[model samples]
Target: MRTFIFLCLLFEEFHVRFLVLTTMSTISLATEYRDVRASEILKQIENGEDVNLTDCRIIGELNLSEIEVETVPNPKYSELLESGFFDGEDLKRYGVNKDLKVVESNIKIRNSIFENDLDFSNALFNKSLFFVEGNFTSTVNFLCTTFGDFASFIGATFGDSSYFLNTTFKSISLYGIDFEEMWVRWDSLENSLVFDGLTYVKLVRNFRNLEQFEEADAAYYQYRKLRQAEKSWILFQKEWPWISFPKCGDIFMWLTCGYGVKPFRAFGFGGLIVLSFSFFYRGWPAISLRSEEKIDRICRLLPERLQRFIPTIDWPNPGISRLEPNKHTQKVSFWDAFYFSMVTFATIGYGDWYPKDKFRKWVMIEGFLGWLTLGLFLVTLTNVTIRP
Candidate 1:
């Protein structure tokens, strides 16, 4: 009995020890996610100190715009300045802009949460600025911000609107930004982004280098669209149809080939046009076989589903050709409709099939579209494949 009692006490002791250890571990984890005021961090940055925060919740606004820093010469104009082509004063006189402030401290905040708005407009960072896996819960702004050195925001998430209007970066990574809240729009930064040709080009190059083809396409598409609009407005502002000519062409390019960047879109659109017209031909009974010889050829290559719908047609429609059940319309198989649609869309009239009187208009339209789509496909293919 005494031995059993001693065993029970020993078990209780182990249980108590386990509970204590677990409690301590929980406390440690909770501490890691401690709340830090955004003001404190701003103070750290203002004092030119390196910030290394992880797994903390930042409270209040961290407006970096208020920090007073001296304006640094823009390195982009450095070569011109060295060549004596344009001094800083002369550049300013010619309306060339310079940076407002420069932050020369290292910031390596990882896996932290910002609960309020953050602004870094018109500020340049000379050191590495990393916010890996950070979460911004409120509005974030980076208007005209420049990262002169390396910067990375990989795996970061933003809950509210985020802007990068006219922002510049060198050796930066923005590959894995999350916008599950539907707040981050890359095209225009919520309509705040101004059109800058060089900025858009850099963004396209950066996205492509990061292997984000879709993002790169979006950037290029937006750039082209904005540029087209600017030119149209400049050339024929307030003109009704004339002003819309450029936009019409732009829209056509977008629908057919995604502005010559996506070859697959042209291929897919071509296929879709063929498939849709094929259904139209079948449903309307628009096409008719020219002779018994062509019927025999088409039946052997008939699709199985089309074969099932067509009666008295053997599994392969072997040695079968029929005249129109009605004198006005021909009862052609689905294969004939598909074949005619393919030939019409390709503008390849083999003279074996002809559209009836009512179908001639649609046939002409399809032929023209086929010509256009094929040409666009080839052009887009060449554009994407044969890059300079």
Candidate 2:
């Protein structure tokens, strides 16, 4: 009996020790978890010291107004808000500065009221910056700010006009800035979105112009196109409830050219067709159809060098050596003429191409148009190709 009692005592003592160790470990883990909160870091900042939030995931809503975070020095925070740190009211008022540097932060300010006048003038970001689904109830200025990495502002709702004048983005993802549903005006300046300081390593992708202003202008144009498409579709739907062909055409054109539509080859082919038709036909005459006067008018529009290429029926020699008139002048429709014109301008001399005696002047006109069109296309292509 004494032996059995001794064994029971030993087991009880071991169980108690295990319970004490487990309790201590739980307490330690809780303490460590609390240490990672933004509240704790804000306290350090409030004490006028620099806090490195590097590789730290903050939890809960961060309210800068409540926490005394001032005079933060060289904070090495990276990949912040990766574990879902919610934003509080007027969040930008707390951390904004004239020369602040934020790198690789996935900050989401979903449904939060941002009333603070966030000023990031001359700020620099060396990594990905995101502002997804946030509501900015006040002005946010990024004047002269430099984004040295990928930047995104998708699904964000701005209360007022956001100023990005003179801001330079190294690489931007702006797929959602269309003004179809959103009513927002962009703040414009004389020299906004300049990309003069960009290096070859930090060039933008897809966009040709490295300048920030040019990119902004492109974005604005895209927005305008989307809005116009939306308006046209709405009018079409209202006017013709039974038929939707026109609306479908508008959508097809918009998808092909306006924004992020697919099958780029189709768009290119359509453009080529339009160009060809315009070239083949002399275009619709405003009034009477005096062929000679029309021909003279068209020739006058041709460039000086091309005017010399005009085939003269008065002489037997094919007036110009390299250039020729359209052979199917009688059979070609407006669209066909347009496509032919594009082909000629592109200098893609297909074998079946020739100019009839009646349309001899048009050959010179087409050649001139082709030269000018090709020159413009080359310039744009060069700008896009040169990354730096």
Candidate 3:
């Protein structure tokens, strides 16, 4: 009976060992099947097949190498994100790698929901990168990525800072991306970039166009205010000459009004003739016959030496002639004076008039002053009219 009990115990032990071996084999086979399934899924993704991970309940962290993900028929990016199957940790391990290739992917997230943060920093894209008409309910990071071709984010919305610092793109477009009050950084190392009508503050302030970099709002306000202030300062300088020359206000008024600077300058040099005649002839004829000859008689009474010194003095018929003997007796109108002064200063002789000796030389100096004043006026006018 004891021998029979020992054999039964030995048989029971053997059966227990056999059951353990079978269970282990079954577990091993199941594990191999899971691995094979995972590999098949990866192959399908690489072959540009549509993948729907929406119904997947348990998604473990996946680590992959040298894999490719292609969007076959332009699946919604947000739908994939909301499928509750893509864990951030899994993406960090399997999706974010320089060796991994993503080609011709049309990633759209049209008003879909998301429950986690998406980070694609330092990822290399070798083909067309599209995020057209998508909505990101969380922060999206695309820092330091090298886009080998066209990168588009047209009509995408971001809930936080859309950081793209040190990112390189051959061509980019962010036609409509609302970032409420976030800052966008798109610093690049190349040129030939364009940004048409991008309403971002940081973009407007830093870059000249939108084809290369993304946009932001805070930078826009800063640039706008700076440009406005510059315009205001230019206007003030044009309108208020006193601001430039406080004590010279009366001098400028005399040049403009009393000397007939405006009208003379506008006449295109017919005014110069009038001024020459006024300086030489002095005044017009009077009604009285004896009074008409009075200036002549007075001029003749002067010494011959004085007459020689002052050639403008016409001793023979000083009353009728433009040249009179006495300087005080010569009365020149403002318009005539300004014209003569401009011609003498510019040294452009009309030949219809002449200046008498040293007196003419003195008048030439006054002409120089007139030319300078007119030039300044024109410069100020241009500044006011055509601002930078």
Candidate 4:
């Protein structure tokens, strides 16, 4: 019955998607852009032109991968250096002997759509680049690209995998981006990378506001892991023992409990500890109750009326009392050891089994460990359950 309901839900979802896709109207780009040829665009830039596609959509594949769009010189710099009165020799005689590198021209393509993969690998942009309301249907690559000025991808949609490996931007805006699956190597730029909480907070908020809790949790999880890694690395670099010890503890907590990302790991670790102590108890048989022979002093301390009322306390019969030590082997069996270990870890002092005087210190230590393990397990379980 549950399987039937799930199949119905899946079918309904697909039906809705099909209706939406078929009902949406198609957009044309030829009406807005005079020419869509790459050669024409390059030639125009070479002849001092500013190409702007502020709201155009491309219907076919737009191949701009590995293209050097930074070959265009800045208008201001060209006017100052390329005047007819200034010759190369005249400029060389002065201290201005540095090579004239090309300055990047502005390429604005806001509110656009690419029907195919958009590859911008190894591209250098000196001016601000805007992709507001832009949508790409296939993979988008910005690998090894350098942005000398600010870049914005606000309100953009990426339909497939997006790569930003080794990409550098002076300042970036990632507001309301429809992040499908972005591949990034943030550790390679750890020293220069700076991520403020605003963007990630907004991302999480946007997903949660849409009632996409699983997506929101995923984003938040990634955010937390990144934060932990960054902070842990910083702390691990400290040379002082006191300062570094806490960091080591933090790493250990992550490995054992996943910093509340995983609760089962903590449970498993605690279970292993309990089993190990069970073996210790099996070898030592640390627990035994006081015999009836030792109860004479207690009977003497009791009042006359109370002693008569509690006959068993006044003259305890070893055959009738369950609190007496077992008459079997001195060493406890595996099952008995496990039972006692569990009872001790729970701090339940059953009268039938009490720690022997010789092994009292070991029992105390085990009790302390049990307290810590149980406390950590509870806290981690609560965090994992309630936070997400």
Candidate 5:
């Protein structure tokens, strides 16, 4: 099934309903600025000059929308979009907004601050572009932006949300970019930013193209989680327990195995299951032992002082099991109970010990759980390891 990627939303920092919102620009503006106007920078770029500046405050909105139209056709293949940038799957929902502004200038504006919203929506840079350590006091939009050469945003901080909605790409680096919240929107009907389900699908495919399978899985996991939430709501609206099977199944898949991204969760849950059954066996006399138990016999082979700590019925004799039929049975150690629980869970009935009375019912349940968890573990292992 083709997931609707438009749901990835503009909440690249914001929109859920009509607009994706950024959380970084919540605080009251307090910084003072005395620097070049953003209009001048646009003029410089338009004049085909490389403008490099450091520690400068950019005043006025750096809106790249009204620039000379030089749009590149939306990338039709995954490989073409991997090296620089592309119209990501997020953009596919809105019927391809391809009126991209071409910025061929080599610009490096590092350690600077933007006093207004930085709207570089659909801007394509043909040269090296660096915005390292820059601070955006307001929303920073990078919707459908494409970098043809080196593009880096290392140590950048967004006071509000810096959006990458429908972000096209070739190659880019974003190390240590700080932001408070990321918001996504699913307003495909009227809003221009149509962040739907294919956004994540495209992203996951991109990661796989680069041979970053782990990242692809992680991205898929996030997308599926978000999709599950949406599905749960839709299911709730349509019907109750009768239609809740899908929702319940989704939750189970996520919790038991992280939708298969986290394989170790199965083993961890299995360990918990074993311990829980062990607690039941330890508190009550569930398992029975014969006169001279094999464990105690093995304990005798150890040093005298160590044998006391080995969960043996007696230090010297296996005859202790023969002495008492009632009171002696209750003196079960945690290890013995644990061993019995493990034996039952693993379906390895050695017959050295066996569950007694109603406790056999619990043994059956534990055995079932063992099968389920172990099966999940194997499935998850293959999911994380095999697929690209």
Candidate 6:
């Protein structure tokens, strides 16, 4: 009986020990910061200390919204000032009389998990802010927050809606920013989405890596449109003092060129101008319709150089003399006038129909129009062809 009682007691002790170990493991895996406040976070940043919350699960929201960043003097420079490194004359030469002040606020929260909303709106981060592989379960706001130095959100996951309206970054590194469930307020930030230089290239690469071609294309298109509008706005601002000619030029560019984004629009406008000029050319005796005999007589009196400018007229001899209208002296029909206008606009100048009198001015204008639109079309076509 004593032997059996000893065996039962051993089993009971083992079970109790196993239960204690399991309970401790469960506690360790649970959320760490269930009662952490925003004040603690701000204090650390304000003291020029890095805030690292890697692999932590906070119970409540992590809010740092509208936190003011204070600039502090550089320690190295401060010590130099105390040691009198810059004497009176030396200070004047160096152009810095007092201690150099530097600002810094670096945050590193890689692999962290936030259970509730995370707000950093209107918070100024003077230095680096890393959120690599961070996961936010609820809404995350970064509206109007300025990252002065470097900011990275590589492989971050946002479960709910996120806002980055008016957010500014100096050196941002965005790779694998999953927006599948992140409702970023893109409409409000449309104009601000004009990513240029390296940022643009990186954004495209990131989207492509994520297999989101449509998003990348849309971003590229918006980038192009914004660039054109920005150019126009800068020009308009520069010529604001004497606005007459510049205003007219701006209007022309906007209506016909889409401020430079839509080159196909210029083609449509050119077609209308061609038709208008053709109708005008047909109305008044704007072109000279000389007879074949007159053309031959004129060519005979011209030098080689001048003859090249004038076209050759080959009259078909019908073996019998018929009293029909001469080919050269034929009246300009609607189709014939249109053809002439088109060739003139194309700068072909076939010399079959020559502009006469006041029509010469109109021909020159049409030539310029044709050249402008043609150049625009080529540029636009090339851009469309090569665009990613």
Taking all chains together, each candidate's TM-score versus the true structure is 0.44, 0.32, 0.31, 0.39, 0.45, 0.40
> 1 or 2: which has the higher lDDT?
1
Model 4 misplacement above 4 A = 1-50, 59-61, 64-103, 188-388
- lDDT score of residue 249 within candidate 6: 62
Local accuracy of candidate 4 as per-residue lDDT tens digits, 1-388: 9999999999999999988776663333233533254455455445445667765655554444323333432232334367776655664453232222233666667777777677665456667777777887888877656678877787788888877755666777776777666665434333333345565665566556555555565566566666666664333435642345555666656655665556567667667766887667655546653444433343356467744552232222121121435554243334445555676676765554567777788778777767766677788678656754
Error of 6 at 256 (Å): 12
| lDDT, residue 362, model 6 | 85
Count backbone overlaps in model 6.
0
Highest TM-score: which candidate? 5
For all candidates in order, the CA lDDT equals 0.71, 0.44, 0.45, 0.59, 0.66, 0.61
| Range of the 10 consecutive residues with the lowest summed lDDT in candidate 5 | 185-194
> Distance from true position, residue 388, model 1, in Å?
2.1
lDDT of 6 by residue, 1-388 (tens): 9999999999999999999999999999975543445567666765778787766665666665334454333333344456776555663453332322233657887787777888775455677888898777888877555566677877777777776644555665556665543323334334433234455455555555555554555555565454545553333455464435555565666556655556678877878887888777766666654344544454456466854663443323211111225333344445445666787788877665677766688889999988877776777666545655
lDDT at 44, model 6: 73
Candidate 1 vs 5: which has more TM-score? 5
Tens digit of per-residue lDDT, candidate 1, span 71-157: 776544554467888888985664344654778779999999998898876688889988898899888877656777777777788
C-alpha lDDT (0 to 100) for residue 29 of candidate 4: 25
Superposed by TM-score, candidate 5 places the C-alpha of residue 83 at a distance from the truth, in angstroms, of: 22
Name the candidate, 5 or 6, with the larger TM-score value. 5
149-176: candidate 5 lDDT, tens digit per residue: 7677777777886666456545555556
lDDT of 6 at 115: 78
Give me the candidate number with maximum lDDT. 1
Candidate 4: residue pairs that collide: none
